[model samples]
Target: MLLKTDLTSEQLLAVIFDYMAKISSESKLDRVLVLMANMGREMIVADRCTVWLIDEAKQELYTTVAHGVKEIRIPAGTGLVGHAIAAGEPIIIEDAYDDPRHNSDNDKKTGYVTKSIITIPFRNNDGQIIGAYQAINKMTEAGKFAPKDMELLSLAASYAGKSLESVMLHQEIVDTQREIIATMGEIGEIRSKETANHVKRVAEYSYVLALGLGLSRHDAEVLRTVSPMHDIGKVAIPDSVLNKPGKLTDEEYEIIKSHTKIGHQLLRGSRRELLSAAAIVAEQHHEKWDGGGYPNGLKGEEIHIFGRITAVADVFDALSAERVYKAAWPLEKIEKLFREERGRHFDPAVVDVFFAELPKLLQIRDELTDKE
Candidate 1:
């Protein structure tokens, strides 16, 4: 059955605003397409609506959302939708078959005979065409799109462009923030004269350990970013204590141990996620599996997961680094140390994960440092 009546102007405007709000609330591209297609079907009462997205890198179009049809891929200059995109304009055909631009392969795949079609380019705020929005079989007594129908579609597309631009802008902001944090973490490593690459390896090791232990991706990312802060306390230690070529006396050792508490003081009382995780890493990165560590001597599960994961990563990197007081240990020796310390000094689960990825860890070690 075809819809013979037109919706009032006020009703149509309300529906468009509602569609915008729904699209804004979604983050995933697929979900946005689904929302858009469903809204298009209801707003215009079309027999079927399908959304196609442009793969700018590939110069091809791919299906994003579909109803009553299988998806299709068309080159940017291939058919009606493709021509619309290339021309940056909409095309309305009263008889799809009569139009030379109509591609029958899409109808063949969907098993839905195309009577009439409306194809419009979906653009972003910059006026760049991102994809095509097509409604097939407009379900009308006349079986044609009038000038008024085209006007309404143009209006909807204007809003769609702005909405898509908003999403892309938000993603860019998130990527920029992550890059800033990574750079800041490296800066913190440099404060102790440690190589930037060393901090990267520790963070990677922490992420792998968390993933191997069945932590969520979000948790793993948090640990990876926060793990580098484990040694931030070293910045406060005196140069005499930090750069000594020989063993520290009892008095100098006390000053070195104070770094853990000093780090905790520097990072506590933060509500931001990474900062809070950093505070945990600073305060407990040195804590042993048994009740023999400093500050609070928290043992077993009393330690936070971020601290536990970072402890394994920090210790591994330290043993493999060439400090003034110690030579770098061989990978074999580091393995032995982990085996010996399991559940007594290091977390048993973390140690297991470390050994599981020992080969990759060695690769990361080599890639990060080649200087003996």
Candidate 2:
């Protein structure tokens, strides 16, 4: 909320126009939220700010950007935010505590003291209220939010509803994609007697490692969706080879290794990036960092980065899970195995990054566990 530079009228309009221009279904909402809040602070000379969306069905206001907050949701007509929404207009409070409508509970809960405040309600084209933008504790020497602050905030809040709708559309598309990816991955694994959640855990672990290794968010999400198909080739193997309860015989092991090529062949030459990436991961996930793995035996950096990442992710999840042929390894033993396998069975850099993000990896494990 602290101003690094003075806000001129031209600069303020520039910030608003920039975000408005970028507003679309695929635009990054979190980045937009941060920018909106920061720019609001600069404009109002306030120490804190929040942008909250209304859930008309539930008659609630919720915000994800509040300070020290996981999420804050309050019923409509409950506080200053509610008052502004219910009034369908802006409210400026010079003395926050003096106003009965002000809610100090959030301030107390977050260890922040509220002194002055401004609230602006956003309205849709239909004249329905959509949300409220609230700024708290003006840092000006007067220690008060002026009418001009309310006027500027109202103008900014007007465009927020359009941005929110775009974000919702984007989220709907992503949710549909998640279901489709999970289904495709599950189809291949379920046929082989493997745990249905194996593909999911692999996908999650791959994403974590991808992000830890400095991959872009787009690349990380792509890997998460595509890594699930690493074993799609196993669908071609006979059930006798796939679901064998005991150790695989030498001939059967060879057959199992052929799944890499079989899976790759099944998905190769697809123009779609998902299928293409899946094909590459399917073929190379079994390839080792030391060139000792089956199929191609490509070594070290010769293996594709996606393959290297998926290999570590797949091996970690497989080793730690209880399969029909083996007991789950102890967490400590798994840790040691990965450490020992670094630069031998796994890419040294990928292994290092995988372990560095161990907490998130464990969380992913818990999130996509096999049903008991």
Top candidate when judged by lDDT against the true structure: 2
Candidate 2's error at 38, in angstroms? 0.9
Candidate 1 at 102: error in angstroms?
A: 16
Q: What ranges in model 2 sit over 4 Å off? A: 1-26, 55-59, 68-70, 123-129, 183-187, 200-226, 232-241, 244-280, 287-302, 328-372
- Write down the worst ten-residue block by lDDT for model 1: 172-181
Candidate 2, 92-142: lDDT as tens digits: 888888999988887787777788888888765567777778898888667
Candidate 1 Cα errors over 4 Å, as ranges = 1-177, 321-326
TM-score of each: 0.62, 0.71
Candidate 2 overall lDDT versus native: 0.81
In the range 70-158, model 1's lDDT, one tens digit per residue, is 56677778788888988988998888899898889866865668877888887886678887778777665666777777777666666
Q: Give the candidate number with the greatest TM-score.
A: 2
Q: Where's the lowest-lDDT run of ten residues in candidate 2? A: 19-28
